[model samples]
Target: MKRLAPHSPATLACTMLLALASQTTPAAARDADKPRPVVDFTSCAKPAWPKADLAARHSGTVTLSFNIDSQGKADAGTVVKSSGHAGLDEAARSGIAKCRFKNGPGAVQMQYVWVTE
Candidate 1:
């Protein structure tokens, strides 16, 4: 009868092979567990004074901070920064509300910019 020793080469080779196999298996894939935000801009309606502003005059960017729940729904967020115009800010928020993310667990910060043409 022969007894196998723990430090034998056969034992080491078997252990290494098991570790390699586990690493290559797709079942071990890890899902992203971080927070992220999805952002988008809504098409601006014709400006009241398009003739004077030419779209560029009222063009500006707004920054919004929001939390995405595990289900990937955009929770009502705060307007961290504004484009100095109430209309533009509202537009940005409206666009953000329409955006959706994948079904997962995470959160993110995003910015939406609106420009006049």
Candidate 2:
């Protein structure tokens, strides 16, 4: 039988955190347990993209972090992680910035994807 090498402290810590995070209730579910965000993606306008160019030129995920204010409005958040393309990231940011949420409490994190062939 083969044995794997031991994980470093950092790696172990990251694994533990990931496990804990996964076990925790999702943001949406937590919100549902309380008052749901008034401006959830379902209610907000879907972000639009340049389909033709996107399909031909770019493909990746745009991880955006935006605050859903008490009013349910989506305040402009940071791009913590991004897809490779600047244009795609910018587009996602712009789309999210335009969205508004109904009255609610706390902020929410959102991620958008832009894929190409």
Candidate 3:
């Protein structure tokens, strides 16, 4: 049996970005029992892996928290969870900021995983 190094390329696994269950603020007149709408990222471009991070083989998942404006634009994206790497975290934050959701005026949180090829 052979062992692979932790930082080795063979040990790296890329995970697709996943949008977890969302939470929304209820409108003043809206019912509390109604389900919140899902965020639609139809116009979002995928985040690019930071060149330096990739060179150093940094990998982790970044969780971003943000609010979507009425125009469907994500505003004030903050890193609720760090990926243990600044580059990866910033990449996720900037990428998500450009996203436009179909249903907006609410809060959203999503995760982006970074792995070396």
Give the candidate number with the greatest lDDT: 3
Error of 3 at 3 (Å): 15
The sequence of per-residue lDDT tens digits that candidate 2 reaches over residues 1-117 is 544333333222210000001112466566555654444455545555555434445556767666666766767767767777777677777777677765555554556765432
lDDT over C-alpha atoms for residue 88 of model 2: 68
In angstroms, give how far residue 46 of model 2 lies from its true place.
Answer: 3.5
**Per-residue error (Å), model 1, residue 52:** 12
**Candidate number achieving the greatest TM-score relative to the actual structure:** 3
**For model 3, what is the error of residue 114's alpha carbon versus the real structure, in angstroms, after optimal superposition?**
1.3
Instruction: Please give the distance, in angstroms, between residue 49's alpha carbon in candidate 3 and its true position after superposition.
Output: 0.6
- 71, model 3: CA deviation in Å? 1.3
Write candidate 3's Cα lDDT for 1-117 as tens digits: 687775576866555576754654456236355434355557777787777887678888888888777788888689988999999999889987887776556677888888665
Q: Rank candidates, lDDT, best first.
A: 3, 2, 1
Higher-lDDT candidate of 1 and 2: 2
Candidate 2 vs candidate 3: the TM-score winner is 3
lDDT by residue (15-99, candidate 1, tens digit) is: 0000001121232245333323332223223223222322234655666655556666667656767867666666556556455
